[model samples]
Target: MKTSTVLIVILALAVVALVARLFFFSKSTSSAASAVMENLMTRTSIRAYQDRPVEDEKVEQLLRAAMAAPTAGNRQPWKFVVIKDKQTLKAISGHFNTMKMAEHAPLAIVVCGDMDNTYPADGRDYWVEDTSAATENLLLAAHALGLGAVWCGIYPMQERVAYLKDLLGLPENIVPLNVVPVGYPAENPKPKDKWKPANIHYEKWNGGDSAVR
Candidate 1:
């Protein structure tokens, strides 16, 4: 074959290879994104847990995820108390009627908001929102790690708050938000679909047909 014709043939093969590589790359990227969505959609509140312990590395990952949450004005007013002692867990379960599941779980993380470290002015209440976001992240991380967890709320309930403060030796500035019990799942439950069409408003409340597309 002529020199020009040979070069053209080589260029064509190179183009074909490049297209194939791009196609596979796009597919793999989409698959990875779908995996993340699947994890989020499948995560459910697991109250029953097996008699198994979570690994230290997984616990670290859960905390890492918790702290990665966003905070107001970067105040990041949050603290976590990791409870693994069996007696303490039992005490928690016994003390709070709503937290009976804690009696059996191997681990519980107490998410707290630090009043002294957060915004002191109008944004003072932002600590509650900040710590709540961290709690959600911790729960998702636990589910992703194949461990079960349920958020047992504490703060806002004066009795619960005071009890945990004394039990966990929390400081005056630290406020317990919730206790998350995590362990190997003893039962599997489907995630609840909370989508509601009537609850959505387009631009304003009662926006009418303009909301529909």
Candidate 2:
């Protein structure tokens, strides 16, 4: 074969290889992105949990996921209290009118924010945001791990806050944010339709897609 023809064939083969590589990479990337979105969308608040307990390794994985959450200035002003005792779980269930699931759930995690890490003791400590992010990460991780969980709000409710603090022996500087009741799922609930086109806007208020619903 002529050198010119050989070079042309080599170039064509190289182009094909590059295009094929890009096509497969794009496909794999798209699949990964779709899996993530599906996981997020399908993850639902599970209130009915089985009596089976979560294993120690799984629990650790959940906590690890929570600690991975992003925090302001990397303060991570968070503390976690894991509850496995039946009596303590019952107390939490009884105290919160809406958190009855805590009674039978095999585990509960109290996500708290540390206030002493900040100045003034009363300013925007940013603890709330930091711990909130941690709590969300925990929930998502639980769902991914085939565990069921529910968020029971505790902070902002003065009486509930005081009760939990006293029950858990938390210091004045630590604040309980939420009680997460977790266990194997006993019931499966559908995720709510939360897409609201009217609530979304582009660069400007009028730039939203009108056809979205």
Candidate 3:
């Protein structure tokens, strides 16, 4: 074969290989992205659960995910109390009206923020954001692990805070943020379509009188 013809054939083969690699890479990326989106969109607040218990392995994975959340300055000031005792679960459910579903849950996880582990001065309150991020991660992890869970708020409500602190024997430095009940789901509710284009502002607020819903 001619040297020029050989060079042309080699370049053509290289281009074909590059195109194939790009095509597969794009497809893989798209599929992975779609899966993550689907998980986020399909996750709903599961209030009802089955009598079945969540496995210990899944519980650890949930906590692992929670701790993997981003924190301010890497403070990671979150604390978790895993509750599997029936009496404690019942007591929590008995106290909070909105959290009655917790009584029947196979497990409950209390998300807390350790004030002692927070940032200094004005940034101290950043613990709330840090723990809240952890809580969201926990919820998402539960969904991904095929377990149902719900976030029952506790912080800011002094009465609830006091009750949980006393019940769980939490120290003064540890502030409870929320209690999450986890188990096999008994109800399959549709995810809410919370997207509102009017709520979005590009670069700057388009000043419009829209009351917060």
Candidate 4:
């Protein structure tokens, strides 16, 4: 074949290969992104719990997942107090009326943000954010593990916070953020899709698709 014809064929083949690569890469990336979004969307918080208890090993696994969450500057400034003690759990549950659901939970986890452990030399505060991330991880991990969990706020509520502080003998630097009740779910609830396209902006704040509004 002529050299010109040969070169033209080679260039065509290269163009085809490039297009195929781009097409496959785009599909793979889209699939991965969709999977991640689905996982986040499907995760739900459970309120009603069964009488069944969570196994020690499963609880440990959940905690491990919680601690594995990313923290600001990799500073894991969080401590978890696992309350399996029946009396202690009952007492803790009494502090918050909204947390009565915890009464049926076989195990409860008290997530505390430890400023003493999380503070940088500059005295910047990262405890709240770090502890929040940890809490989210715990909740998501619990749902993924076929366990029901609910986050009952505590830190911001002065009465509940003080009660937990006094009851647990927590130091000044340790602040209780939330009490999570974990156990088998007695109720099956589906998660809602809270995605509002209007809330999302692409590139700039071009106001997402009007259909979303």
lDDT of 4: 0.84
Q: Positional deviation of 163 in candidate 2, in angstroms?
A: 0.3
Look at candidate 2 and give me any clashing residue pairs. Answer: none
> In model 4, which regions exceed 4 Å deviation?
1-38, 121-123, 203-213
Q: TM-score for all predictions?
A: 0.91, 0.84, 0.91, 0.77
Worst 10 residues of 1 by lDDT: 204-213
| Model 3 C-alpha lDDT per residue in residues 1-213, reported as the tens digit of each score | 999999999999999999999999999999999989999999989999999989999999999999999998898999999999999999999999999999999999999999988988999999999999999999998998998899899998999999999999999999999999999999999999998766765655658643444
Alpha carbon lDDT at 71, candidate 3? 91
Query: Local error of candidate 2 at 56, Å?
Result: 1.7
Candidate that would win on TM-score? 1
- Model 1, span 22-56: residue lDDT tens: 99999999999998898889999999899988999
**Location of the lowest summed lDDT over 10 successive residues in candidate 3:** 204-213
Local error of candidate 4 at residue 94 (angstroms): 2.2
Q: Tens-digit lDDT track for model 4 on 69-119?
A: 888788899999899888878887776788887777898999998877876
lDDT per residue for candidate 2 within 1-213, as digits (tens), equals 999999999999999999999999999999999987887888989999876879999999999999999887777789999999999999988888988999999999999988866434454567888888999999999998999898899998999999999999999989999999999999999999898777776566665555443
The models' CA-based lDDT, in order, is: 0.93, 0.89, 0.93, 0.84
Q: Order of all candidates by TM-score, from best down to worst?
A: 1, 3, 2, 4
Q: Show pairs that collide, candidate 1.
A: none
Off by over 4 Å in 1: 1-13, 207-212
Model 4 error, position 190 (Å): 2.1
